[model samples]
Target: MTKKKSARQLRGQLMLQIAAGRFFRPGFPLNETEHRYTVYSNAWFIGDPPIALPVGEVVASTEMGHISSAMIAIVDRLEQQRPDGTDDFVIATGGTDLVDDLAYLMSFALNRTVSRNHDQTRRLVTGDGAPRGRSANDLFPELFEPRQTVQPGQWDDLRGFMKDLLSLSRDDFARVMRVIRNSVDATRRAPDDPTGAYTDLVAALESVSDDKLSTSVTWDRYDGSKRTIIDAALIDAGQEVADRVRAAVLEAERSGLKRRFISSTLARLSPDYYRDDAAGSIRPPRAPDLERMLGIAYDIRSRRSHVLEDLGEGVWLFTDGAETAYEPSFERVLTLAGLWRLIRHVVRRYVINAEKVAPEPWDYREALPGIVEMQLAPQYWIWQVGGLTAETATRRLNGFAEALIGWIAGQHSDGLPLDQVCQEIEGLVPTLPDGEARTSLIATHVLWHAWVDPTDHRPEASTFIDEYKAVLDAPSTSAFTVSLLSNHPMPTWSADDWVAMAQSRNDTRHTKSQAPLPAVVDALIQLFTADELELAGRHDEAVAFAANAVTELPGNEALVGWEARLVAGDHDPDFDVRTFLFGERKREVSEEPSGHEQSGEPSTEQNEAVTVEP
Candidate 1:
């Protein structure tokens, strides 16, 4: 009833066929073409080693189900292994010839031929195993032009970036591969079809951009308002008309392809293009010009897709060293080369940002000194510690503060460049686990060093005070002590920020915990804490907090001044508060205990239950 299939069908396995141009020149130990290099975990081989090809021939093959699958795996592996954007090995893959075991056996028996025809695989059997004098380079000169030769030691460097590329997710890997394919297509098609090449480059960008569109409806209010007004006007209209109108209004708010394309491009476009640069030439366009240029390109692509409009041939000629020529379609047209550059810039930035690469330990060591020098002035220096957790940051806080104190105190010169002497502080910050809280704490410490360095060439008191006030105005310093010290109202302060600051201060004071700051800075911050309490109409709490501060720093002029203000009900102090707050005061330590250290609670002893005189 049933017919038996031949043994060939039962034990079927296909040998992989591959013909790819070598992207890099050989300068390493394996320079001889006889050695078949195993790559991709030996999934494929380059050159025939076991059975060496005849002179002037090369081989790279594997076993796989299909040629497309095998080629995709090889190409993706090569793309991932590329060290930099400039290098593209595996330049172009040629036609594949699949030969099964039975076919191989039959061919071997007949004439020692395993392939359908030996000549079909001759592309892989070419002279020298290089693309020079080959049709690949002739067709895709743009790729060949920037090809890099792999020197002996540099092969490792070529493999180095693969670690980063390998970290991509399934979706990201696919997206990147798609981009590489489209980019290659663009280059290959550029000579024959400028329009296709341009569209391909733009399509490569759009592939990533499709997922980049903001999900939040940016025109929600406009859509709602228009719908409300139109609905009011259409109250008497039929239900069907009203439903159609509502649907139209709702659909208008959804983000479209053009907006997504432009929005993602602008978001990822390098800031250098926005600077004052050359005009009407190879130099990148300014921001407005770039936006307009991208918009025009997008429109042209749309027209090409929908209406079969071709990008004028002038674009190719102009980009290929031809002189200035005007196309009436655009006043400032971006050449194909310019568009590719912009696309490359955006795509690379996107990839790097997506990678979210952690700052290497050495990166911090090298960059901290320069960052300190630049932000040594009163600006907030946010350390970029990618993906570090808050708990790790909190754990490392004390060590970081102690390190800064030692670094600042260790300076010898009358304050050598504050940043230079304190440069190591920044290095220590990133070494601590990165987190929002960690970065905020680092910013607070750096600002404190800038304000009160033992090194004398630092910002003057007035300047430092003004800068500190400015920082508080923005409220970025999230360290517990600094927030309590500068407890003034922030213009954009959220209630949660205030609550967190208040709770942190309460906890510290309740346990009489040792302050992270120097004694003087700690005492001054305590005084400000009392001032904040007073301002909040907590008069008793204000007096108690200030009285406790007096206990902490007995003879400090600022603390004494705060107590005197409480006693005299002098909310509007006649004295120079700045002088009282910032003037040089020697540390006058009293041997007499203030009757508070014995208990682990704030001293409730107040001079008077006085409120600020209104």
Candidate 2:
């Protein structure tokens, strides 16, 4: 018999077991690492078949692409926090409400075109160190001309800083977070009483396995502070002082946030910590070393500092030594480290013995009505598809494109030029800062059109679709290829077999390329113009450009027939493309060719037509 499957062994399959209520949980002693692995795996996993595009081709996603892009952009922003001891970076003049959303932040941060001295952006005011209108919220927000400021220095234009940040890629976020994640392992340790709970907290707080995490954690010597968090975590006052710790764990249960429960409990014991509306804020606990460490952590998280200097190793010295070198970002990380230790202690002391109430993940679904009520931008696709690679993300985009194009086509607007509807899809994506991410985005755009438009001559649009098939067919295609690393550098696949494989690749792009419905419609117009050119000199012969097309699926039968007849038209090669496609429109499709129509003899001379950008 297979030894009962562990949560790790089942992978995402464990969810089904839980749903069925017929599963044996993996045996205990699960460490924090394993616990984390299980938690995240269940929370973020997406296990289902790929979705088909609205046009019956497979792309991905439904309508939530914008949210994902925003999330990814935010992640990118957070990852930029410096991992060094120096705290200096782009610090805003403190207003977070207007500073939400990744794309908005990125775009706002990166914009250099705006003048910094403008009335709206200038920081210093007349007669004092304040905003001209007292706050950014007030109207007529002007500042004294720069020359009149008390402290002659530049301040960050919060909006401008965000705009600049947008144009970059945050691939480092994943890598750095992965490193932080590794330091946090888990075990499903059974709940015990408060005995040794404080010691456990101390051990947990000091338990960062990697020195790299605390690299930036230092304090100012000149500031007259006590000890840094590291010193507190590692402090040892001897075994004889065991009685000094909390005599017993707070016997409590019945909870909302454990945050509220713990803070309220700690309130009765250490009133200063929860003093007068200062609930959840930090205050020192003088009883034990573990308690002291928790206080240092609470202070760093709330006050954003570690007042004391860190001596070598985990020791502290009270001398007026070197100048303080504190980094708030580092302090935040230190706070988290300390908090995790406190969490371990709380879990063992109070949470373990309390009635085990498993989390209900789907409870958030109750907020869907409210969630959908918010206004969201449509452009960024980062967060919605961050978990996916370039290929999958593009496919999701393709699905969006399909929905858009189908909506347009269903309107069935007669005589409307494809160009008229193509406004939504104009420019391809620019080379975003650093990655192969855009590779599949562009490639899928071309393929999405190839499938949607019945008359895109593959030969003339060579500039836009050079060896696209080869790229599509490459075994290594993925979301990363959209990055700058390897996708653009791919050597041209000139081999005939590679070329042949990619030739029909449009039939299977993993996503929608977010190209506009009108763009494909307009491309057909250009193809019609091109057909006029290809058959220009031959007016006395049958028109048939795609007559030789090997595969003739009934899906676009009418379009194929129209294209073949136009190409093989026996009319003058100078035949007007617009007139032929619109004025003399005949949409009746046929399985076999409309028995060859007479056309002018094929000629070598080509004629100039209007230039249109695809």
Candidate 3:
């Protein structure tokens, strides 16, 4: 058979179970059978340990009281440290007796020296017997009057025999008044009733005297009377007392005294009572409520106001109850506000930088193709130039071109060399025009340049070319020139080449027929040939002259096509030759019959068709 556990072991197990249940089974009902049984068992174990208490038991009780006193003393010390300096000493010291009693009870229940100061205080005041070592008389001296036997006759010895309990601190005084107030409230008397429960409170207050010990009682009586009497004098007196305390606080603040201490003391005396201005004398302005006060301070700091100059120092100086030797200056305030604005500006710039508002150079180039398609259209250009003159429109076109060039040159995979681009564009600005039209023109020109020049490695080059073609197809004089300029194979062309081509075209005296078509073609070819083909090297006359040869052989489709292909290499330059021919020769050919018919005869379609020798 297994051996039964010893009593001590069983008790230890029970204690452990109780602790575990309390900790882990949080939602378990205390009223449940298991919980009740556990609590009862724990209590029994506490009261009756394995060993009984010694016969004397003096050591246990004495030790309990000592521990209790130590706790009370510590609490009393903390209470005394309050800066308000109001007398809470009675409440603080009275706690000692309570603590001692609690300790004794705990020692009795646990059969061990376990001190419970909190419980001791409750027992001393409310317990049945006249408290053990000390009576209520000794602990609360302000609560009772001196006992005296009245002699026979002699006005019944009324003066000295009267009890006075008014010397109590505000807390104790309020506690007594609250008791009366509660009694009145419980009665639920109507305000119109003069001889009601509230009047009874007044009668109770009147029983007290006018000495230091009776001041609180007198004030309480006065206040209680006002409720029923409706006398203006009583109302004014109550208001006067409130005003005095507020005045004290304000004076302390103005004089740079310990305002916090004064204010705290006042608060402790009567938390709701504060001064208000009376008629006749100029009462100081009532201080703002805490939130309003703080908000005003913030506004002053925000605006950096110097309005506190007359009072000395700054507005914040008054809050700390200290005066600055030097007064605030208007200039200083303005400077501070300016500094704040500057700080905000810097912070915004930094945040914007972190967010990367400007993209990398590679990103711009990558997006260029899409941007050109969306923004550079004939209608869009016209819309941009709306009311501008041709001269203005041309200037804008040039500026836009320069801007694109700058953007291309500055672009890199890492980041756009924005600073360099800006500098270059700034240099080009003087050579360009002003206004929105100028901007649009310059942009169109730069886009055209990117489309025609294969050396321009901008990722958007193809998109630019496509958009340029779309714009050229739209019927407009400007669109024709833009398309021609963009599709022209003249990436290497210099300013002189353009001037020479114009001069050569003027010299040809080409009407809208015969030499007209060839002259136009020749000028384009010559311009392409004159471009700076090789970096820092002499011009290649062979390539240049070869390009010109294509334009010279008019009506020879094969030769012209070959020469054009050679000049542009594998890249197909986007140009509309039909549109150019139509624009220049449309009027000249409108009256003539189409080549589909023979001249002076209605010839058959087969005879009208002539094959040109290749």
Candidate 4:
């Protein structure tokens, strides 16, 4: 019923054709020219031509040692061709010639050998074989070291080079170290999960920026905008929809930040973002603009990508592409590197703006001695701190030098010379009256808390009143040195300044109506603080104060000349600093202790709300 198909219908004709010698070319031994060329090529490339053999048989019969030697010989021939002494290997890959096949094998073997050595080195350095729990930096620190500031002289031609990383002060340098640490951690966990690190890296960025823009998502606006998945996909895929994509990027950026804050300011910078000028330059990115860019980068990393729908609620929900672990392709790694560099620039600016420490880099160790020697008469007792070298600064004096340096710099930015300023402050001393009140103000009020060594425990230690009554019944009458013991030590005090000082101290606890102290009382306190120097029979010290204080008072120069003449002849006896600086009032205050209790341990709020009496 059915015709039987010949199973070998084409086979007989093929056999007959093959037998006829026309179907296949009769083998001709290499003719004269071909034979010589083949012999010359074999001689030149492989040394003496061996008896022809099947490739499998040649490899099988020859020991690996000789085969490897042949491979090395092939490599040497390649290396000899270049004049610069560099090796080059050009393989005719399209052909199935024995030389090409051997070239492929030789290259593979060399690469495999290199990879094996690298694996061994990594195992020795990191003590692990797998990517789990091991960071990319740990395995290849040379390639993956996270950088914040640009290296010095790295890109001199670029404008960003002027604002490079090394320019950061010590404080700002410390802030960006956190970013580097977190980035390393992210890369370490990338094998299994990049999201934890993704989340952390985002948080680190926000932490540095002061996170004032996180709630800027416009639910109604994001839902209403017709930014299709296809548009976001084009950007994610690195397609060049320049104007359309840039507008979308900028719209999202502006929606997150204040409109007034964004403009050509960032654009005029390094031109990493949109370039407004025909000549490309980086625009300065606002905080919100940077944040939105980071978010989009995270999306490209598959975190809340626009491929997911927001459902008009402003929240992107997972549908298909989202996952905890991500494929860390080279493209994603490149995107992240770019994002990190921009983040460094933005965060450095934020730290500088918020910190109020003086921008001037003054060392307190140098400033303190300069102030004492050139400026004030040496009655003020600034504490003796140890040297400011790295080894001793922490162990000896603690952080005192650092604390005081910052405080002094913040107090004044005036252009006046230090010596001139001290002279002016001394000028105000003679204007106040000379009496016991001045002594009390210096010994008990002003100098007590500000000057005395914290380690002292004498009556002067526990209390800071000096008894001038022992030297002279009423103490020598002269306007006291105002500069040494007062906060405004190195500046002139006007009549208005004296009143303002009293008012400032008074304002601390009292209402404005009750803030100003009695001017007469303040003048009286000034009188005896300087009088104590004269009372100790130290006529030289007394004369110095009087001359420094008064310039216009009639007969003041004559009085000072007479006092100096008298003091020149007077050889003062050994002085008792304790009895001279501390008075009977100190003992009385300690003995009385009625209004306030004295305890070794201070209460948490001890004397915190004391009445302001001036």
TM-score, one value per model? 0.31, 0.19, 0.15, 0.23
**Tens digits of per-residue lDDT for model 4, 364-394:** 1111111122322111111222212222211
Q: Which sections of candidate 4 miss by over 4 Å?
A: 1-134, 137-142, 145-338, 341-614
The CA-based lDDT of model 2 is what? Answer: 0.26
lDDT of 2 at 16: 15
Better of 1 and 4 by lDDT: 1
Could you tell me which 10 consecutive residues in candidate 4 have the lowest summed lDDT? 34-43
Q: Write the per-residue lDDT of candidate 2 for residues 1-614, one digit (tens) a residue.
A: 22433323222221211221122122311111100000000011122322111111111122231111111101011111223423323322111111112212212122111111223223212213432222211111111122211111111333222222221122211122222222222111101211122233333333322222111111332112433443354367454343232111111111222323334323223333224323332321223333333334443333322344322211111111111122343321112222332332332222222233332222111111111122121111211322344334344344334333332333222121122111111233342332334554554444334433435433434444553444444422331122111123433333333223222232333245432222333233223333443444533222322332213223444445555556555333343433322334423222111111224322222211221111
What TM value does model 2 have?
Answer: 0.19
Model 3 ranges off by over 4 Å: 1-288, 305-404, 407-468, 472-614
In candidate 4, how many clashes are counted? 24
Q: Identify the superior model by TM-score, candidate 2 or candidate 4.
A: 4
**Candidate 1 lDDT, tens digit per residue, 1-614?**
22433322221111111111122223311111111222211112222333221111213344431110111112211121233334433322221211222222211111111233333222222212543333222322222232212132322322332233334432353355456546644654565466777787777878778434533333333345565788788899999987776666545533667667777887876665444212333444556566556667788788888998996655555333211224567666666656655655565566667753321111011111111112121111112133234443332333333333323333211111223313333444445554444454454444445444335433443343443334344423244334433233323444444434444544565574333333444444445556666667667766765776676678876567758788567753233433443344412222111112222332222211221110
| Candidate of highest TM-score | 1
lDDT of 3 by residue, 156-226 (tens): 22111111112222222223333333332312221122123222322222222112221111222222434
In terms of lDDT, which candidate is stronger, 2 or 4? 4
